[model samples]
Target: MTAVFDTFYADDTLVDHLTKSIQYSIQSGGKRIRPLFLLETLQAFGIPISEAHFKVAAAVELIHTSSLIHDDLPAMDNDDFRRGQLTNHKVYGEAQAILAGDALLLDPYLLLSSADLNASVIVALVAELAYASGSHGMVAGQVLDMDGEQHTLTVDQLKKIHALKTGRMLTFPFVAAGIIAEQDDEIVALLRQLGEAVGQAFQIRDDILDVTATFEEIGKTPGKDVVADKSTYVKLLGLDGAKQALTEYLDIASQMLTEIEHKTQLQGEPILKQIERLRID
Candidate 1:
């Protein structure tokens, strides 16, 4: 994944400082959960991991990184640090940071198009990624999140917000894997369902961590959601309730994996292991 990013920015045509700023943000530490989930899903589908698969995973990570860069800007979370380092805006100035984010966000399409895959598969990945990260998906969720800061949000409302924001991006990896593997529509649908369950579980765990984890534990400022009065699973549900919600989502994910395996006779243990790793305990 790092090699993919390094090679992408190695071109001499890009401006020096702009390229440096973008590289700095991409190179900064992150869990790389999106790409990891993606690659794992492909493996579960019995697809041999190759450079083309890596490119698709890299595209997903690029989008995630762009979202993080923008989310930490002054107009958003206004954080000074991310991943225990200065936020992109803090290090590169807001203008350059915005440009860096824009590049990351837009470059994924180019990366996807260039991947060594069938045109139809590449098209599916591109469309799914765009919708997942665009207005009806992540952006819509971000709007709901900001609005929720102004007033209390019900549990259902909070779920809807996250379903679009966090869930869509997380869900894309499974869908992309199915596409790359040329699975039947039924199997692809099951993968999407599994992805959604994992996505929701991931968000619930994050909400729990925001309240409980230390700066070192989370690699960022702790309690920012609480400070901003943002609606979260923990805010709507009590701590125990939030944990229960997390468990329920994980169970759903597990069930989906079972269903997929039963239908396809393919082992889903790799994806299940990735899902289990999200559990705090």
Candidate 2:
């Protein structure tokens, strides 16, 4: 994956300074869970991972990185550190950071278009990704989150926010896996459900960590959710309640994996393992 990124940025056509800034953000360590999920889904579907698969996975990571960069800006979370390093806006200046985020967002389409896949497959990947990342998905969710900050929200409303913001991107991997594996709509729908369950669980865990984790554990300032007066599972439900919710979501995810395998006869162990790893305790 890093090799793919290195090769893409190695092109001399890109501006040196801009590329460097983008690289700095990308190279900053992250859990890389999104791409790993995509790969695991593909593997679970009996699709052999290839360079083409890596290209698609990298595109997902690029979009995620872009979101993180923008999420850290003064207008957003306004954080100084991510993954235990100064944020792009803090290190490269706000203007450059914005540009860097924009580039990361835009580059994914180029990566997808150039991937070694059929024209129809490429088109499908592009369209779904655009939807997942655009107004109907993450952006709309972000708007809801920012708006929710001003008012206490119901648990359902909070789930609605994250189902788009975080879940759509996570769900895209399953979509891509289904498409690549040539699965039918039924299987695709099942995978989407599984991904959404995992995404919600992941967000709940994040909310739990915000209060329970230290800076070294989370690689950023903790308790920002409380400081910002944001609605989170931990705030709405107590910490114990949030944890219970995480377990419930993960159970739903496990069931989805079971259904997927029963229907497709494909091994879902890889994805099941991922769900198990999400457990905090």
lDDT values, one for every candidate: 0.89, 0.91
What lDDT score goes with residue 120 in model 2? 89
Clashing pairs in 1: none
Residue-by-residue lDDT tens digits, candidate 2, 1-281: 99889988999988999999999989999999888988888887777899999999999999999999998998988899999999999989999999999999999999888889999889999998998898988888888988888589999999999998898998898888888888888998898898899889988999999999999999999999998899999999999999999999999999998988888867988778878988988
lDDT of 1 by residue, 120-217 (tens): 99998999999899997988888888888957889999899889989999999988888888899999999899888888999999999999999988
Query: At residue 36, what lDDT does model 1 achieve?
Result: 87
TM-score of each: 0.98, 0.98
Worst 10 residues of 1 by lDDT: 265-274
lDDT of 1: 0.89
Model 2, position 241: C-alpha lDDT score: 99
- Candidate 2 differs from the real structure by a C-alpha RMSD in angstroms, to one decimal, of 0.9
